[model samples]
Target: MSTPWHIQRMAALDFEASDKDSETARIVSCALILVGGNLPTDTRTWLVNPGIPQEPGAIAVHKLTDEHLAEHGAPAEQAVPEIAKSVAEVVAGGVPLVGHNLGGYDLNLLDRECRRHLGDSLEGIVRQPLTRVIDTMVLDRQVAPYRKRVSEEQGPYQMRTTAETYGLPWNEEQAHGAEYDALMSARAAYKMGAIAHTPYRDRPDWVRALRTNRFNSLRGVTVEELHERQIEWYRRDAEGYQAWLRDAAKSKEKHDPEAVIPTAWPLRPVPAPRNGGDR
Candidate 1:
């Protein structure tokens, strides 16, 4: 008898690209597909030749040189099919497709790449739709909606720091690279699964509802209104509050001609001296 679908393992995909605007950026990097519930007993990765030259800036960040890729990586077309097949098999067998941020980036990129690769021969087997993508980004954002003491200018937002909010220690240096990203993604999902299995799991659902409303509401607003909302939101944040207060205290006459007045203001008091007595 065949193994039950539930007995089959679910998989997670972790992908990184050089540029969000390019095709390669849409479907690049290594993947870690696991073969179990939440955590996998086995994982695998694939290196893809994005079919375009890796941008110098992107290459600098990822260190995936085109020269090395040309020698070691599989072509995008060849690699994508294999990836799709693997993902489909797992999903069809009743396992969820998990990724760090599959809903926002990785899955869409891979889907695009797979569609591009399947070309005319796209059929029910290879080109059919897949389901149950568990997005770690959505999960993390659900846990902590509005709390960033400091925003990072670099690194995967969904991976390193976000994991920390959940009491999961994520080492960016040790956990970078596509393979590691997927592994960590799986780890994050496993952690989430534990919560989802708990009494407080309803909290994530409530947050999801709020995010859905926020996203839908954003789509209804004007671009200018959206910008204002974002600015207002940031202004309410710790970093934003500091900036808002700093600008507010500045003289209108001394305001930079190039800068616009922010719509929101902060009310934070200055911190007291560390010593008991003022210096």
Candidate 2:
């Protein structure tokens, strides 16, 4: 199949849940924005009834509560299938889903939510492997650290932060909604792709902020190559963070020294414990 890495066809996704723990969280909202003709050709949003109470902390982030969901949201049984259809349409049209931090969180939530409602994950529901996703979070962090300000304590790869660094407009006040975030993720990916392939000298002067960090390596690459490179980068990143935590002297975060972070590309199923209860 031909690659769908071009700006005019990259489909963007973002989702919100009822809680912070992806394994336990229920998806409350989902958004997909398809870019074509230099603008979104189609934009879809869904509000789902998670069938669980929304946590206060999570509510503060996306502002959907149990009461609100109960009153206005569609049941997961109804919403998940429709969501799958939207994704399938994009995939069928030779477009890949792209989003920031999507592989780390949103995809996991999607897998579990699909399992809950359809007895299988998205690939099962959509009836095709979702191998075409382009996670901008992984791509930006791996290929363009020169495009960000990362540190030992924090990698600084949040969507909004990356947007600001890449000379894309951002509004903290209007962020966190599924639709807003999904659109921004698409916009950010477009900016990143331009920087990667476009000659620095040819870009508009407004892109001067990223001129010095030219990523010519991303040019002339196939979509499969781009996807596989992210797998390597994400694995290295997770393992490196684990190594750092093991060596930190005064860290406040709790990490099990024996715990192994996932090296799998995109999302991994939550590991089952002894006795194989969840397996």
Candidate 3:
């Protein structure tokens, strides 16, 4: 017997890549942690051999090197498709794939990887209703827009900062590993929901202030409804950002030549940069 989607789990996703380029970075690893039921359980992690040289800066983050992956990682064709299928199966079963910064980065790479290998995006392979997603970074902003940030490390509402804000456990040693980051994202997502569901009076003073949050609308909502809300939120966010960019460009007489805000809601597909052969 399976738990209902509403009561089942929200999955948190994270990926580490071989470069910083959103369009060209080859994904080195991807991880997802299911957050309902027992939570921090039902996790999946994939280490992929992108068959490309890793940028030094990227190595500084996840620490996976060409030498390391050549020995431990599966070929892109083998690993990317398998991972996509696994995620699609869960999505088809009504699990919402959640993540921090996923819409902007990880999913874009996933789309390209899937197309690069299987000639299909992850959603196309699912061949069912589109998978739902909850972006922790996106939603956190809507929930608490005025949180202070005095430094790069504090980051205001960034994933790591959000975890700290919610008093969730974090391990610096395991911080950048996809599995660890995904787990932290899952916990942060749950913490957001906790704030939404808990009554104001009984909560701690800090949480009590969020009693009037936009996320309050999520309480008792169905998985489908929560998914819909995120779409609406993302649309508003993208348009607002684009408008700001336009205003800035007019003032500076220079714009993001492309000036395109990825309005694909949860996971925008970025085109792969020019390459002779990336196989």
Candidate 4:
């Protein structure tokens, strides 16, 4: 079997989108952080002028106001592709692009801008089957059984809640600045990766098995056969234990499968001793 890439490259992205309908055509803040391979640990940030006024609520969170953006920000057309370049470079480097909820939110916003600005260049790179996309939200749920996210415990920015269940210090006071968000996401990825204790950790065979679902069978038999045997043993053990539990529950006047057994079913009792002693 071919060895999986040891380099394990991943990209982390965050978008500080505008909340105004007028600025809907433009995004206020965008950033991408590439944290592996030959890439330098640099975060690319963009402040789009958006050609419209910023919403009051958005201004409260990110503090990128209409006046500030109009005075200092670049035009949306000029800024979007620069952001797309950051995305395209990381993706082209054979890295799986990751975000908190890439599937539902971030990628959509990215694709929208990519189509509007870069056109064909964006189409060639952004939308591909081999384009590895990892959603951290899905990964966390599968790994950790139960946990609730605290609202911006480690930062002041009111970002979406996450099941990450850990906190890290970030300069949230900087707020809505793409560079700060990208750096925070990079740090979050490192922290989450350390806690993901799945079978794939440091084990190429397990990763391959998980990806392919073609388990490694010992000796000559197929993995399917071995799996069936294991399942049968598990069922036998489970049934025996369950039967005992049912009987105990019935004795305590609780619901049990055996309690529903018809009277026709033989009920075994303790045998009498040879000397007529208590059995």
Candidates' C-alpha lDDT: 0.55, 0.76, 0.76, 0.51
Local accuracy of candidate 4 as per-residue lDDT tens digits, 1-279: 322222345566777666632214357877776665556765667778877665678778778888888888889888887877767777666676656544435665666566556664344544543236554443333333234435435422133333223366544466446656555554554444443322434444323434332212211332233224333333443455466557765436553655322111011122345697531
How do the residues 192-263 of candidate 3 rate in per-residue lDDT, one tens digit apiece? 777777776765677657644575765777667777787777777777767766776563664454466767
| TM-score of candidate 4 on Cα atoms, chains taken together | 0.57
How well does model 2 score by local distance difference test?
0.76
Query: What's model 2's TM-score?
Result: 0.86
Best by TM-score: 2
Whichever of 1 and 3 has more TM-score, that candidate is: 3
Give the C-alpha miss distance for residue 98 in model 4, angstroms.
2.4
Q: Candidates' TM-scores?
A: 0.61, 0.86, 0.85, 0.57
C-alpha lDDT of candidate 1 relative to the true structure: 0.55
Residues 199-221, model 1: lDDT tens digits: 44354554355433232322333
Better of 2 and 4 by lDDT: 2
Work out how many backbone clashes candidate 2 has: 0
Ranking of all candidate structures by their TM-score, best first: 2, 3, 1, 4
Residue 265 CA displacement from its true place in model 2, Å: 1.7
